[model samples]
Target: MGRVTGKRVVITGGASGMGRATAELFAREGARVAVLDAQAEPGEAVAAAIRDAGGDARFFRADVSVERSVGDAVDGAAEAFGGLDVLVNCAGIIGVDKPTHEVSEAEWDAVFAVDVKGVFFATKASVPHFLTAGGGAIVNFSSIYGLIGNDEFTPYHVAKGAVNMQTKQDAASYGRHGIRVNAVNPSTVLTPLVEGIARDFPGGLPAYEEQMTGHQSLRRLGRPLDVAYAVLFLASDEADWITGVVLPVDGGYTAR
Candidate 1:
């Protein structure tokens, strides 16, 4: 408990799924949280819940794809929480799953806008504050699909690959400045969006789960908290020396 005590955290996509779980966990550990998302109701609800639970939390509506929106939200978080200690880039999209030849240019661009560009926008906005404070942690949500190849999901994989490389580059560039950057690559987690996707699969949710379970040595799908715990570790002081690495929270899926 209290691993991130007194830290001020800004999490994009904090309204739901892994982002929400992380926000709740960070708040529980004594961090002041700012949840940024396009979804107003759920975002505000998350903040209210945190406050009701005796944690300092607030919600700010922002679109990750827009630089100005990202900048404003980061600045707002810094202002509200006194200063930003951690920035978690959890805002992302899967886009339409299609082969490279079949995917449209617009499709590719759209995914890049949110998946890859959003990370850049958020990190870019936070870097100055981190430098001012002498240090900070950045945890980006990449995907197992980014590390490996698949016939479908070209844009998503490429964007995540870009994110992974960016994480390494940023880590190298800012390590001397006390800024640490890392990314978490998770396999398909059982979020609502993923679950809905699974329902459309050939054999539906059961078959999808079975296949996913088999892909991981742990033989189970990942929960939001599973990934959230890893994000917490990377964002916390315990990982002060850990930077420039891509950590896989894949339930051992990468081992296979």
Candidate 2:
């Protein structure tokens, strides 16, 4: 049997990127999944793909950063799967990039709203179910930028940093309740988020990978699945005692 056999999972930002990849992988390992995203078209497509592959899946259209939408998304998942066991907070935005001083207030707020507040909403909505079920896993998608600061991502960096701290605090509060909370801090991956950043750079992917890989001890760019595998392990009972930790899936990028 697959590691996640018969479990029910709720994945935010499940329409694309790392979120989509992880959700699909989780389904492959035997979890029933509910994909939540603001983009209905792609979200439904992903859900359809999973279901077609003989895995149980459903899709919901909702914005994670909004309270009403987030609540609805949780309800949608609960309706689809009966209850939730895994809450993956992957819905996030890169937001406007600039030096801290040049970044607009709106830019900062928008980043936190999606990256930070979204996690709060998902956890708040899922905690009751988790407590009722006697336990569950909450995986927060943080970043290496959160662990280490960088230029051109003032707000994103701070938001991720907050995500890390929030993960820890939530773990502390919910551990006794049987909920395990953890954050995955990944280095630059070959995601659309990085593709967008590559646009501003002259050499594009080559230059992007060069700089990103150079920082890592492994010196190789990370794939979405790299982070996904980490999430899977943490989402599974394998990581039963790994709460309140910033598990860096950064290809040794943070060792330096």
lDDT for every model? 0.93, 0.90
Cα error, residue 37 of model 1, in Å, equals: 0.6
lDDT of 2 at 201: 80
- TM-scores of the models, in the given order? 0.98, 0.97
Task: Please give, for residues 1-256, the per-residue lDDT of candidate 2 as tens digits.
Answer: 9889988899999999899999999999999999999999999999999999998899988888888899888977886788889999999888876888898888889998999999999889888888878999999999988998777678988999999999999999999989999999998887777787877787987887887788788887788899999999999998988899898898898898
Clashes of each: 0, 0
Q: Quick one: best lDDT, which candidate?
A: 1
Q: After superposition, how far is residue 110 of candidate 1 from its true place, in Å?
A: 0.7
User: What's model 1's lDDT at 146?
Assistant: 85
Which tens-of-lDDT digit does each residue in 1-256 have in candidate 1?
A: 5999999999999999999999999999999999999899999999999999999899999999999998999999998877888999998899988988899989999999999999999999999999888899999999998899977788999999999999999999999999999999999799876988898989998899897778688877899999999999999999999999899999899998
> Which runs in model 1 stand beyond 4 Å of their true positions?
none
